[model samples]
Every structure is written in structure tokens, then in C-alpha cells.
Target: MTVYKQLLSLPENFSFRINLDYLKSTEDGLFRTDQESITRFIVLDGNLFFIKIYVSNNNRLVIETEDVSQSYTKQFERQIMLYIRDWFDLDIHLEPFYTIAKQDEYLKMPISKFYGLRNIGIPDIFEAFVWAILGQQINLSFASTLKDRFIKNYGKRLIHNGEDYWLFPSPRLIASLSMDELFKIGMSRRKCEYIRGIARLIANNQISREKLVQLSDINLAVKQLTAIKGIGPWTANYVLLRCVRYPNAFPINDVGLHNALKLAGSLDRKPSIDEIKQIASAWEGYESYATFFLWRLVY
Candidate 1:
């Protein structure tokens, strides 16, 4: 390991507390967090590093790593900065979203309640695809449980300070596993096949974040992703929203989105897809953020 320590500055108006609250809302076994810091494993330039991120009393963000040395080039620093920015969605300007949402009925309350909350993203394409597939038709809690099991069984682990930090299984690892191996982890055979197929596509370079990111149009991106087996409109849009950071990606069929809208409108039943679409039309360019804010209502 390279021997050095460093501090990274964050953008102005950053709210570590809000982001930490969102992170702690879910019980993720892969990363460990406390009131003071969040510890997770990150792979940079094929070298795995355990990173601890915390905020100083002066409201500055600090990223601590033990692997900074003469060998760490400017490219590595750029990669690290990009990863941190994407993970926290630091580039999005929320003032316009807030302005648009303030006039809207469905998003007014949620936006107010969860102000400063960014749509935390999954930076890894393979992890995002597998997560979207694993969560199909299942409730969020059980999906999280299955994810914990899958990660612990197939993912790499690093023990730091007597705690294990896990990296989500890579495509190469998943592609090499047999169907029976994944099914043994309590995932259905269909789910297993879907994940394995995605893994094979990724491992072979048939699909990648680089390719997806090249598509400037959100509809084109959705169409490209949906062509893969087991990836439907909802999954495609979900991946686009969470992983690709496409502002217009909207999963109108999402149950959580529907439920949140229903609760927000005080409706007797869940809103139909068309109704949700009509309601969402007001926030055209920032539908992903609106959807994320609504998810916060029920999740």
C-alpha cells in the first residue's frame, strides 16, 4: 500500500449530514458507517483501497486514504475526484429543481422534507445492472437482504479495524459461476440467469458504461439497454436514472413512485401510469430527481 494521507475539498452547499442520513437509511452490509465517517472499499487503477470519508468541523469534506504516494499520478487523483463527485451527485444544481417543485403539488412536500438530499448513485455499471435485476418484482427490504447474501457469497472482502468491507462482485466473477451456485444463494433461477447473462455481456465488453455514456439522448440510451435480455423499460429507465445520471429518465411504472404519489395526493388507490405521467410532466428535465424525492417518502 502507498503511504500517504490527504484531504479533498467538496463543493459549496454540500450537506454531508443529509447524504449520511440517506446512506444510513438503508442497511447495507457492504459498507460500514457511523455518525462520524463512512468506510467503503474502492477500486482505482486496479488497486483496491479502503477509503474513509468524513466532514471536518469547519464544514469541509475530507477523503482519507492510505494509498497516496509518488506512484499515485494526477490521473489517479482525477479518477478519485470523479468517483467522489458522481457518488454524491455534486454536479447537479438543485435550485432550479426546487423552484420548479415549489409550484408543483405532488413534489412540494417531499422536496421540502428532503431538501439537500441528492440522488445518491451506483457508480459501477455492473453493480447497477445486477441490483436492478435482483430487485425486480421484490420488495425493497427483501431485495436488500438478497443483495447482502449475494455480496457476501461472491464479493471480495477486506478486513480493516476488525470489520469486513466488501466490494460488489465483479462481472468476471459472476460470469464464471454456475447457475446452481447463484441459485444456492436463494435467488430464483430466472434471476440467476438474468444476472449471469448481464455479467457475461459486461465481461465480454458487449455493453459498458462507456458505451451507454456516449449516447446523448435518454431515449436512445433506454432503447439500447432494453435490448438486453431481462432488461425491460422500467429496468432500463431505472439504470439510466441511477447509473447514467440521465435527468429525464423516468420509471413511471415503479410501485414505490406510484405509492408515494398516492400518499402525497391522498388518493384512495395507487395512481395509474398515465396519471403519474401527467403529474410528472411538470418536471420534465428533472424527472429523475423528482422520482428520487418521491421514493424518499415511502422508502
Candidate 2:
């Protein structure tokens, strides 16, 4: 009785196909993807909506969701549009980054290869934090496996069209969880503690996306996140790059980034931190975009 449909216009250089490929890269079970569309449940303003996102024949982005829109306020409408913009990063214009990347030797090929690709964002800061923790120091496949197990055990689900769609576990749920529960899902002891701590911070109103974004600069933001236990520079920057909408965040020590650079430059071994800095010199204002394209090479 509450399925609502909306269409969003795309940028001139946005590629729905490339972003979809990235979303489908990991079957972490948060969303289900078919050939052309993806369906998932998202929590907005404490309301749950199962949404299907896909491209329309007219080249616009379409979102269909189940909710009682008949009596919804304007804030609800704004929230949905804003969430979609952040989720797919629709408002960002790629022309400037493309201009700079087209000249860099290491990035030139990838920029064209993955042209129109946006750094698909995790709008829920808590979900982004959990993902960064889940992926820390592990291969993507194993990290994904852990996430799949964690969500199935702890996250809520909605069944529609005879398929189940999952919602990332809420902060209140994780804050009250025991380590034993998460350990059953194969997460390390430290990761379990870190996740619970982060959840508690958010659930208790100590830290939230609004608070993080209120910081004046990227360093302050990074410092705030890194100040938390188990969140190093790499994890902090990863969160900023993916969730905080910081274009300058660079996780210099990311192993996937090192491998990508090594393969692209034909280096004898993985690039060291110094080499990564020098190689990234040309990627001043758009380090997040640079890293996303490089990650496409190996991930």
C-alpha cells in the first residue's frame, strides 16, 4: 500500500553501468543486484524503505520504494533525494578530476577505462564505519564473507517479491551486542570490540555523522576518527573517502592501492609509502577519485 517511485536526473558524465559493477563486486548481502537493477532496504529518519535503483530507458536514474508517501511531509521527500544523491554520489562533477587524471601516466589508462565512474558512497556513517573495520587487514573476499555472516545474523530483513533484502544492523543493536555474538561470525576479537564501541558512541549520541561533518577540516575529521581505538590513518581516511564525502582523503598505506600502483607502473615490488606519496603528487585535490580508479584495477 506504500510503494513510491521517483526519478533522478544523472550528470552528463555519470555512468550507471560502472557504478553498478562496483556495487555488484562484493556479494556482502546488503543488497541484491540483477542484470540491470539493485534492490535493498535503507533506513532513513528511522523509517525503513525497500528501494530498487536502476537506469531508465531515458537515461535517468529511477528509484522505486515501499512507503506511505501519501501523508509524508516535505522533509521526507528531501531526505530520500538527498540520500540517493549521496549514495550514488550524483551531485559530484567528474570533469575536473578527469582533466587532471588524463595527464598522469599511472592514472591516464584507468581514468579512461573506468570513465564516468563515481566513488559509490555509503551514506550511513555507521555502516561505513562498520565496513571499514570489517575490511581492515583482510582480503576483500574474506572481508566480504565476514560481513555476509554478520549481517545475516544481526541485521534485519524485508522479504518482497519472494527475495530477502537486508538492512545494515542498527547502532542500538550493535551497541548492546556481546563480542561472543560477533566472534561467532568469524570477526576478530579486536574488530568486534571496535565495532561495538563505535556503535555505542553513535547510539548514545556521542558521535554521529552530523558531528563528524561539523569538523572544520579534513585533518580534524581524520583526527577525530583516528582517535577512536582500532581506527588508524588508513581506516580513518577510508571512512572519509567513502562516507564523509572528502575528496582529498588518501589512504596511503592501503595494500590494494599499493598493488594497483605496482601493476600500473610495472614496479619491481609493491610501492613504499614514500613512493606512493611521490606518485600521488599530481593527485592533489582529488586523491579520493584517484584511489577509486586505481582500486578498480585490482578489486
Candidate 3:
């Protein structure tokens, strides 16, 4: 039972309070949230770690890690920190976003109401893909319910302090699963096959996060990801935005974005695609951040 601890200095313009509130806004079974702390398990380089993070007295992020029955190395510790940094989007500067948003009508409210908020992300590619697939054409509430059931049924877990902490199922495990088993979780047949196909690609080593990240163009990465059966434009853009950290990823046709825009702009009805495109044209390079802030309005 080895433990590792680290204190991270949060970059400027980070509001732990706002980010915590955003995490608390949803009841995803992925992570357990407390009044001031959040805990979840991450598998890095095939080693499992149960990690807990909270704000310290000095406003630094205090990270606590427990290797699941194995000794860990300093290299693994650095990986853990990188994972945490990406999870909270700590390294990116938000001032540029703030500056651009101050003059935009739709972005103004989201930025103000959720000031200091980062685009909290899923750094795990497989997990991000699964989440995007499950969320397709469904409300977030039902998607979360399906995720809880799927994880409990197939994923690895550990009991800590009388509570069960679950890791999202591995690609290999999902790849080995049958259609009937996945169907029992309430996902559509198309979604089931899509997830299995993605799992197979990942488990077979045909696709990887590193490969995508190394691509010279984000568009090429998007093209490759969208080549998968289940990953369309929306899912590809979503995974890229959340996991790969692409600044230009945007899901223009997303209903949530439309609704958030409607609410943000006080429109009598949801904005049309053309209207949204026109409005978002001003936010060319920062579409992902803009969409994230808008989504924060609802969930």
C-alpha cells in the first residue's frame, strides 16, 4: 500500500469553486464528489490508481494517490500529475478567451456567470469515446444512468472507505462483450455495435491517443476519428475537444448548444444553423472553449 502526494499550483484565472459546482451539476457515476473534494480511478500504462483531489488552504490542488496494491515510481507520479492537469485543463491560459468573449453577445453571459471555469475534460480517449457514443441523441440523465449500469456490469472497481469506486471499462473488456450484454444496458443496437467497433480498434492497437495527438492537423485527426463507424462529426468533435484538447472542435448542430445559445441570447426560439454559424464566426479559433462555456449554462 504505497501512497503519493503532490500539491499543484493552479494557473491564473482558475476558479476551483466554479469547477466544483460544474462537477456537482451532474450525477455521473464516473467520479465521486464530496463537499470539497473529488475522487476517481485512472489507469495509466496498465497500472491502476485511485486518485483524490481537493483544494488546499493555499488554493493549490492537493492530489492524493493510492496504487492499487503495487509500488509506483516517480515517472508514474509525473504521469499522474499530467493526467490531473489535463483533467482540470490547468495549463491553458484563459485570458485570451476572456478578452475575446467580452465583446461577444452569446459568450458574454456564459463567461460571466461561470467565470474562472475551465473546460473540465476526460483525458482518457476510450472513456471519452464511450461517453460521446452513449450520449448520442439522448438526454444527459439517461446517458448517465446507462453509464453507471455499464461500468458496474463490466468495469474494474475497488472499495474504499465503504464506498465503491469504479473505473470506466477497458477497451479490451468491451471488445470481448456480446451484443446482448450491451443491449441489456438500454443502449441502441447501432450504438452497441459502434462502441464495440471502437473498442476493437483500440484493443487491437490500430488507434491510439498518442497517434492522434501527433497528427500535424487537427482536421486530419478528426477525419481519422470520424472514420470509425460510431464516431460521426459530433462525436469526433466532442472527443477531440474533451480528450485531445483541440481548440477548434465544435459541434454546431448540437441541440444543447442551440438551446444554450437561445437562453444566452434570449431568443424567442432556438437559433437556426445559419444564425449560429454567423454568430460563432467571430469565435474562429476558440470554438471549443466557446461551446464549453455555453454547455456549462445547462449541464
Candidate 4:
């Protein structure tokens, strides 16, 4: 077992509640046992099993890792929590988020139920990019099926406590995979090509999280990613949200988000893309959290 302690200084009303709620529900990849101040993740991958137990309150994060200490496990732990904070805009002051939440009825409705969605992010740019491609235009259940197939086929494993936990496959391993191999795992040809493209970029160190972070402007970064074949606005924004950990990253056209907004607002008609943008604008700094909450509505 390995344990690490760190204190995260977050503004008031910076709740991990919503995040916990998300893990409990949306993570088929892991199991979450919700507790008042601590939530646990049990990850099983083939022959390896690992658990991440997160205890947070009053702006402090305590992580307990058991039966796994590979470099990637540590990397996974660091990246996942960081992604959650970035996804929830926990670094930002709560005043602005609260102001928007209190003032805008749409924002208010979602935040009221923010505790039911998961923040699934892949910090590795290649993995995140590939995941976004795999998920495009598909229902999430099918997406999960695709992910399970991919993981089982390509991912590495750790065995502990009579169980297995898997890590997302490495870029080099994925780059060597043939389209036929991926097709056997239920990946479409287009998605296979996109994954290979991402793998090539990572294997070559051409496009990376470090490089993307230095781009300094979200719009420019989005344009750069979209320049990649098969990468669209949703995929770009999803990468920013998951890989770059951009607080304001919002996949405006996400079917889950659109459906969640319609359900929450009790609208006669689903909000237009423009309307969604307009309503989400107030929560600009906390867009990820707002999106998380809205996505929660579906789960």
C-alpha cells in the first residue's frame, strides 16, 4: 500500500460531492463506494486489482493507493484527481460560480443536482484523443462497450488480491496495432485510423500535453487539434477538458449535455446550440462543473 497526503486550497463551496456522486454512478471501469468524506475506487483489469481511496474535505486531498505502485498507477492517480479539480473548476473562486449559479436559473437547476455525474478524463493526450474519437456520435452504452473491447484487447494488466486491474494501453503498443486487429475489437475503421494517428503523434512526441499547454490560448489549441483528421469541435473540447484540464472547456454539442439541459430546464423544446451557449456563458469559469452537473442528469 502507498499513501500520499496533499492539501488542495479551493475556494468556498468547492464541493467534491458532485465528483463523488459521478464516480459512484458513471464509472463502469471502476467501482466507487461513497462515504461522507472519503470515496473509494476499485479498479479491476484482467489479472490485476487496485483501489484508490480518496478522502477530501475542507480543501484537502488524501489518496490511499493499495496493491498497485507501478509508475502508471501513480500517474493515473495524479492525473485523475487533477482532472476532477480542473473539470470542476475547483481552483477558481467560488464567488463567480455561485453568482452565476444563483442568478441564472439554468445554471442553478443543474448545480442543485451536480452530485450525480462522473468526470472521466484521460490526461495522456493520445489516450484522451483516441477516446474522444471512439465515442463520437455513439450512445454512451455503446461507447462503454467499445472501451471495454479496446481495453481487453490492448491494455496491460496487474494482478493482485485475486483480481486484475488494467491500464490504458501505451501509445507505442497501439501504434503497432493493425486496423484489422482493432476492428476485431469492435472499433470502426475511422476510429482505428484516428487512434493510430494519435498514437503516431504521441510516439513521435509531435503533439503532447506539455506542448498543448504552451499554446496559451484555448481557441488556438482547439484549432490545432481540429486540424488533425477526424478530430472535430467536440473531440477538441473533450481533449481540452480531459487532457489539458481546461476549466472552461465545454463540449457544447454533446448529446448528453443537450439532453440533460432540456430535462433540467423543463423546456418545451430542447435548447438550440446558441441557447445552450448563451445559458452556459454565465458559468464560463465553471463550465466544466456546469457540464458535469448537466451530464449527471442523464445518469
lDDT of each: 0.85, 0.85, 0.88, 0.68
TM-score of each: 0.95, 0.95, 0.96, 0.80
**lDDT top scorer:** 3
| Candidate 1: tens digits of C-alpha lDDT, residues 139-170 | 98888889899989998877887988788898
Candidate 3 stretches greater than 4 Å from native = none
The numbered model that scores best in TM-score is: 3
Model 1 worst lDDT window (10 residues): 65-74
| Models ranked on TM-score | 3, 2, 1, 4
Local error of candidate 4 at residue 261 (angstroms): 1.8
Residue 69 miss distance in model 3 (angstroms) = 2.8
Q: Per-prediction count of colliding residue pairs? A: 0, 1, 0, 10
Q: What is the lDDT for 104 in model 2?
A: 86
**Tens-digit lDDT track of model 2 for 1-299:** 77677899999889898888888886566888888998886666667667789999999999887772244456776787788899888887778888898988789878878888888888888888888999998898888788788788888877878987777888999998888987888999999999999999989998887887777699998888888998999999998999887889999999999999988787889988987899899988899999999999888
lDDT of 1: 0.85
